[model samples]
Target chain A: MTHLPYIAAAYALAVLVPAAYGLAAMRRLRLARTRLAALDPRPARRETRRETRR
Target chain B: MTAETSAAPGGFEMAPRAAMFRSVDALSSLATPAPPKAPGRSLHRFANPGRFLRLAGALQPWLTAGGLILTAAGLVWGLVVAPADWQQGDAVRIMYVHVPAAWLASAGYLGLAVCSVLSLVWRHPLADLAAAEIGPVGAAFTGICLATGSLWGKPMWGAWWVWDARLTSVLVLFFLYLGHIALIRAFDDPTRGYRAGAILALVGVVNLPIIKFSVDWWNTLHQPATISLTGAPSMYLGMLWPLALTALGYTLVFAALVTARTRAAVMERRIRALLMAAAAREDGAVQVAA
Candidate 1:
């Protein structure tokens, strides 16, 4: 535990940066999906049609 | 004379002349060949956004969960269970974070370069989106690498910063990522922005080899690569195991983030196109009213 402070700082950043980024990415995706569905629900309908065609 | 059968001043009947011209035009069109299809049509099959979105949606959850689980496990093992280095003591634990971030910094850029090629050469729609998404994430990881390296350096190298070849090259990479992120968003037209960013990414690729060989090519305060593809690792097995786990975890997390971001970008583009179409329809209606 000699360099405990340095270790903690490094690990905190390694975890926090990616965690924050990942959460933001997921949120953006959710918002995009919601907006897309509102603007045109055709994507969902298209998916259904695709499944049927398959 | 009936309007349909009226003769022109040139002594030809209007109806027959019109019919004759129509037939000649048809024959001329038939004689001309069709335009050639664009190259890389085959790649379009795999580059379909709808297909990619479905695959990414399915894979995102698994990648996120697995990445989080493995990263947590590896960090815990490295921090608590793994033995400390004989020389560096407990300070060596920083490797769990630092090394993985460094690896990701390099690997992520390579991914960006591949996306750039796909965008520039094949004109893959998803590639531009992927590159746009990858730039910010790669920059973040590169930032993490630099920060963690500084932390490790302060303890090991007796200074927080040094102008070593490896260090300076990585710093250049960080700026390259930043440049790409900015260039891709600079234009009002996203297509133009993507093209500019792709060209920059392709050009920046030369820095990769320089970053890789910098430690060997020049004398520096920074240490040479501890793990290499062609050679066995120089670290202890106890330390190596956790490092490996964390490296894999970081990679998975990187992939998940990029996929999710790219999915969002695709949705955003679709929304933009829909809005533009709606606006065009409104304009047409106004024109009709006018």
Candidate 2:
């Protein structure tokens, strides 16, 4: 049981660090998509412009 | 997207079905798998940034969770409940970390090499991205392998480090991994850097086989394989399984890390494209005024 601590440390480091990194990336992706959506304004404007010009 | 419009009396209009055909087709393609085009191996269309993003998004959490749980299980099983060795005692415990780290260092490089080969041969852009992204993760694991090896070494070998063949080869491997990591991001021209790093990855992979068999080939301080000659392993079942479990956990972690990093890379590419488009539009307006 005592040696268990050593094993636990290795496992924790291996698993937790990467998991936290991934979840953070996913959250960031959501935020980024939201920001981009805001920046795009309205799709109708661009679509109408392209349709009339073409 | 190209279609003919009907010349109606008062207005230029197409039939509703004809007008909506392109959008409908696009929607249908997104919704359906479109059948297995090839039975042996599917064409590599998903390598495109958009499809890659979708697939990677789905895979990210499952991989992260499986990695975390299995790693926790492996740790608990390996360190706590598993019996200690009669020969190496507590020192044998290091194998749980060392073996897996060592295995992954080799395995990760192999993955990198495969991507490199694909990049070189098929000229797939994402292959280079894939290869480059795994560099830091591999380097980190390789570093861990070295540190843990040294920690184990100090106690058992009567010194913190030694110039033994196996250790030295592994140390060299660590450097190669580090060098690859440094080379990829060091250049402004990302293509030049990715190609350079790919070459280095391929070159360095040769050392894997050398490192693996170095103990057998030369006089060395490192012990031979812990799992023995044949069926199962010579080691106790409890210890072996836990070692196995830890290895799996490490592997899972590696998979998750690469996916996250690669997804970030893809998003960054899209962000750059968006900015460039915005900048181009601004320039065009300025030119029109002039």
Best by TM-score: 1
True contacts kept of 2: 0.15
Q: Which ten residues in a row have the lowest lDDT in candidate 1 chain B?
A: B22-31
| Candidate 1 colliding pairs | none
Candidate 2 lDDT tens digits, B1-290: 11211122112111221212211122112224634652323324545666565656566566667767767787777667887778566767777777787777777777777777767776666667777777777777787787777766766677768888888888888888789888987899988888888899899988988887888898889887655323335567677666656666667677777777776666666667778899999999999999
Instruction: Give the alpha-carbon lDDT of every model.
Output: 0.78, 0.65
lDDT (tens digit, per residue) of candidate 1 on B96-117: 9998888788878877887788
Given candidate 2, what's the lDDT at residue B12? 16
Model 1 spans with C-alpha error above 4 angstroms: A45-54, B1-40
Instruction: Give the number of the best model, judged by DockQ.
Output: 1
Q: Scoring model 1 with DockQ, what do you get?
A: 0.65
- Ten residues in sequence with the least summed lDDT for candidate 2 chain B: B1-10
Residue pairs with clashing backbones, model 2: A4-B79, A4-B80
Off by over 4 Å in 2: A1-54, B1-35, B38-43, B228-231
Error of 1 at B68 (Å): 0.9
